[model samples]
Target: MRIGLLTEGGYPYAAGEPGLWCERLVRGLGQHQFDLYAVGGSGIPRPLPPNARVARTADLGGSDSGPTARNLLERTAFGDRRAARRAYGRRERRRFVEALHRLAVGVCGEHTAGTGEAETGAELGIAFAEGLYALAELARERGGLPGALRSDDAVRTLESACRAPGARRGAAAAGLPDHLAFVEHLERTLRPLSLDWYAEDALGAADLCHAAAGGTTALPGLLAKRFFGTPLLVTEYGVQLRSHYLSAAGADRSAPLRTLLAALHGRLAAEVYGQAALLTPGNAHTRRWQEKCGADRARIRTVHPGMAADRFAEVGEDEESGDPATLVWVGRVEPAKDLIALLHAFAEIRALQPDARLRIVAVPVRDPGSGAYLAHIKGLAAQLFPDEAAGAHAVGENPVTFEELGGPEAPTLEDTYASGAVVVLSSVVEGFPTSLVEAMFCARATVSTDVGAVVEIIGGTGLVVPPRNPRALADACLALLREPERRHRLGAAARARALELFTVEQNLAAFRGIYLELLSHAPVRHRPGDGVPFAHPAEAHVPGSWAPKAAAGTGAPDA
Candidate 1:
């Protein structure tokens, strides 16, 4: 089957977790044809799988020089730029204003007091849908949405909605700066409407549209389902709305601005969840988030992230556990990882087991703040273990060592996981905990803080403690360190569970079924002169069932 795969900042253009998983998915599902619609990223895309090709790519930076509608029109025999511009004149302007007004109002309004939340929510949803589709249609016709959305008129309409009676208090209090900020964000969010992929030869021609993530990436799939009869399958490893909230929480923006933006995202998420044919969240954690944001439980499925376990096979299968007294932590060095707490926890562990060592192995820093955070961690380590600080220069006598993944000490992930007896995760905020899964793949026992999907991923195979609690984290680590037999049993179980559920083969099998299941229920779409296999089956022309008729002499009833 032909699949329209929608993605953003991942897939062909970027090299990261997002791109890796997508590449694996494409390579594994070689039976299906994939047409990728990638958004944003500059460097060369990785080589495409045999069955996959990039259908279109858009820059999220909004650098499109020609609108899709105008370009398509100009290519026609009688089409001209002047005529296209005239098409977006007075009448089109009125339509755009009306649609934008309705959308802004829907986004700005709050639930009524007397009316049940369900009723008011449904009404707002309807309003939002009407405005969103009307705008999409206008973009298809005039291709002026990108320009008009950035115009003064759009800001005025949004302001009027915010100031209207019964608007949410935060929205009513929005200042000029907030209005400008929101308009810019809104333009970027709705930019997908202005793309040329909505035509019959693009998203409309696909057997199914698969959105690789939620939020802006899903906009095209939403439009495809609206404009054509294409079914949309939305898969979200990370909840986009949750990410928006986290980023906004850290921003220096006003409460009113944050409130307005939150409402916009919440409304959009609700729409996407409501319309999706099926919602596949990477884990139960994301499934709950989707449900809270209005996804139907019946339509939701949990699919774990897939990992390549072959690289760690030797480590996992090895019966000998490395240094029984060593505890290792591996991941990126970020504030969220709470390495400070880990350091404190290790201090307690050190007091109990002086000979015990800790390896603080980190991947290369990605965020600008990470380098500073890593430096702070190193400083704290020095302060806690002053004697060890000096011993580091003398020899490898330091109880705590900080090293990068590919450095001299730890040349690879397998070496990092194999070098320690127990794996530790002290993250205060985690999603899926890829490092913990990596430890499991290496057949290493883990002691992780209870955050995000830690408990779920561990599945009773390892110990989990409360986040930010040094005592608890330390105690859990000690329990595993003291019991060699228990650690061996848990590590063996972890490797078995990882192989059963988290391998790439398992992930590919799940999606292969999901794709066929979605297609099976979708209405068959056949166009004229198409080279479809059974487009005009002989039995389809008959009104009744294709049962054999009784013999003419028998006068029997038709079977």
Candidate 2:
């Protein structure tokens, strides 16, 4: 079978998100051929397994134009020509206008009224889907949507919809600049309409289209399914819509613009969830989000992300290795981790057990603000532990040590986990909690805040505390520190659970079955010149119900 693997800012790039898992999947399923279609990020290719190869790669992250000839080709194909603009007939124009109006109404309505307004949300969702498909059809028929979507007509349509009665107050307040900015962003997000991947020679040739994530990455697969009847398998480790909400929450954008963008993303997410044959969320937390966004419960499956457990095997088996009085926190240093709360909790724990140590081993994040956040955390640590030498750690001298993952003290991930008896997760916000699972794989007892999937993953194997509560967090840590027998019991249970459900082999097995099951039920849409089914001599004699049976009197099969 041939698979078209689609991704945005992930896979086939060394620095890509979820790159390792994707690589593992491809390498594990060597029997199947894979054609990768990637968008955004540095287009540098990674070393792929022999069965996998790059089919198409595009960088849509910026506004830079490529070669003149390519630009001309795009302009011509996308109906940038004045003659082509004139070719948009009265009927086509009306359809385009109606589509935009419906979409804008949906966006604006939902923003003013909440999603709990079921009648409005449902009506708006239907309108949004209809408008989206109509636009897709128009783009397909008219060559491209760039010219139409960017035209003054589109902006006017948006403005009129925003100002219309029953529209959200925030949307109605949008100025001309806000409308223009939104239109530009929408065009870029919908750029898949102008891409050539939907052609018969491209995505149409694949047996199945597997989207590694949602949002723009799934856009191509959506188009392929629309045009070619190809089945789409969407797997989301993190909900893109939720990420957008968080990002927009922190962005310095106008209220109207933010509301408009949120509505657009929400509608798009609904459409994607509605169309997908199967929705595999990395955890139940994402599954619930998808359900709220309109994904069918029947189609949703929870596939826990696979992690390599071999590296932590030795530590897991040791049982009595790490210091009994130490607690460790591992992950990227970010505000969401709530390291400040962890410090306060540790201060409380210090009062109870003066000999107890806390180790905060973090990997530096790529965000520019992370440096400042790290400095803030270090300052908090110093203020809390006034007497200890916190700079360069001298092992037992400092009660709290802040170290990087690859530093001389903590050379590797396993080393960090192995240094402490209890792994602590102090995150106020989390998704799947990969570090918590890693600690589980290391056979360490855990104390994590009740955020995201922490409770779901822990499943009574470890202690859970409420987010933003230092006292609760401190109490949980104290429980694990005071009772060695309890820690051992939880650690053993945690490791057993990790081995049973979260290994690479289990993930590969699940996907292998899903691919075969999807392909078996899908209708065959063979391309021209493909070889006849069962043409080989050996294949002709294979045992199956379809094979002809021999008559009782003769060796020859019945005609």
Candidate 3:
């Protein structure tokens, strides 16, 4: 099978969870050929597997007239520099405006007041999808939308939509600057519409389109399905709409601008969910988000993110290893981790058990603020528990020790998990809780805050406490620490569960089956002069069981 793997910002080009997961999926499914379509990736992509190759990439960074725009035209315009000079005629400009106007109206939250939510949602969904596909068709015919989206007409359309009656209160307050900002953002978000990858030679040839995420990353997949009838399989570990909300909360944008952008993403997410053949969420928590966003319950499946268990196998089997008095917290140090609360909880733990130690091992994170957050966490630790050890030989070092994963003290992930009896996760916010899963793989007892998929992933194998509750967190950790047999039992059960559900093998198996299932139901797509193995069998044309027998006996050719 030929798979079109669509990704954005990461995958192949950047090193992150999305990239790592895509790389692993491509590598694991070596039997199938993969064509990677990436957007806005930086740095040299890691080595491609033998069965995979980068088919196309679009850089969404920089402004409309910047180098990136020129590069996009050069690459997607089939090497025709004259394509950049191609402008929409009067009629073409009108078509573009109409399509864009519908899109703006769809996203600007204009609906009949007092209407039921279901009716309003259905109306908005239809409008959004109609406008979205119309714009796609326009872009496909015009070669690209970068120029058109940056035109004055596009800004006018958006401004009119925002100021229209019944539009969102926030959107109605948008000014000229807000319109310009939204136009710029929309251009980048819809950049995939202009990519030439939808031709018969590119995504059109794929047996299945696997989107690495939702939102803008899935735009290519959506187009492929729309243009070529290729089935789209959308997998999201971190919900893109959720990320958009979190990012908008932190951005310095104006209220009207943020509202407009949020509406755009929300409508896009709903469209993507509605159109996808299957939506694979990494956990139940993500599955719920998909369902809430209009994804069909029957089409939704929960596929847990896979992890390599071999790295921690030895530590898991040998339960006797690690300090019984030590607690380990492993993951990127950030505000979301709520390390301050963990420090306070640890203080309580220290008062009860003076020998109980906390080994806070920081892993690498992409955020620039991580360094500052780690420094802040260190400062708090110092203030909370002043080191009584003035000399090197003082009874034992402070109960809390901060170390990086690759440092001499920690050395490796396996060693870090093996160095503690109870693994702790204090994240007030989380996604799939990769670190907790790793701890489970190491067969270590865990006490995780109730966030993200913690409760679902733990499944009663480990102790769970409400997030940001220092007393509750401390109590759970202490309970596990005091009962050696209970900790060992829970650790063993966790290891069993992780091996069964969270291993790389299980993840690959689930996708392998899902790929075949989706392809089996999809119609065979063939292009002119393309030799597609069984494009149209005799049964497809003749119908019924007798057709196969008749063809066999008469030596008749397939239709």
Give the TM-scores of the predictions, in the order they appear.
Answer: 0.90, 0.88, 0.90
For residues 237-346, write the lDDT of model 2, one tens digit per residue.
Answer: 88899988887233766888888988889989988898888999999899999999989999998888899999999989999889999999998888899999999999
Clashing pairs in model 3, backbone N/Cα/C closer than 3 A? none
Q: Tens digit of lDDT per residue, candidate 3, span 1-559?
A: 7899998565688877778788889999877889998877766878998889988887877542333434443333342223323566768878888998889888996556575867976887787788899999988997887577766677778888888876889999998767766776788899889888989889988888999899999999999989989999999998999888876233667888888988999899999999999999999999988988889999999998888899999999998999999999999887888999999999999989989999999997677878998888888887777653233444577778889989999999999999999999999888898988889999999999999999989998999999989999999999999999999999999999999999989999999889888988988665665433453341233334564565578775543
- The reply for model 1, stretches above 4 Å from the true place, is 62-87, 248-250, 392-396, 535-559
Shift of residue 53 alpha carbon in model 3, Å: 1.5
Model 3, backbone clash pairs (residues 3+ apart or across chains), number: 0
The predicted structure with the larger lDDT, 1 or 3, is 3
Candidate 3 segments exceeding 4 Å error = 62-86, 110-115, 389-395, 535-559
> What are the candidates' C-alpha RMSDs?
7.3, 5.7, 5.5
Tell me which residue pairs clash in candidate 2.
Answer: none
Per-residue lDDT, model 2, residue 203, is: 93
Q: Better model by lDDT, 2 or 3? A: 3
The local distance difference test score of each candidate is: 0.84, 0.82, 0.85
How do these models rank on TM-score, best leading?
A: 3, 1, 2
Ranking by lDDT: 3, 1, 2
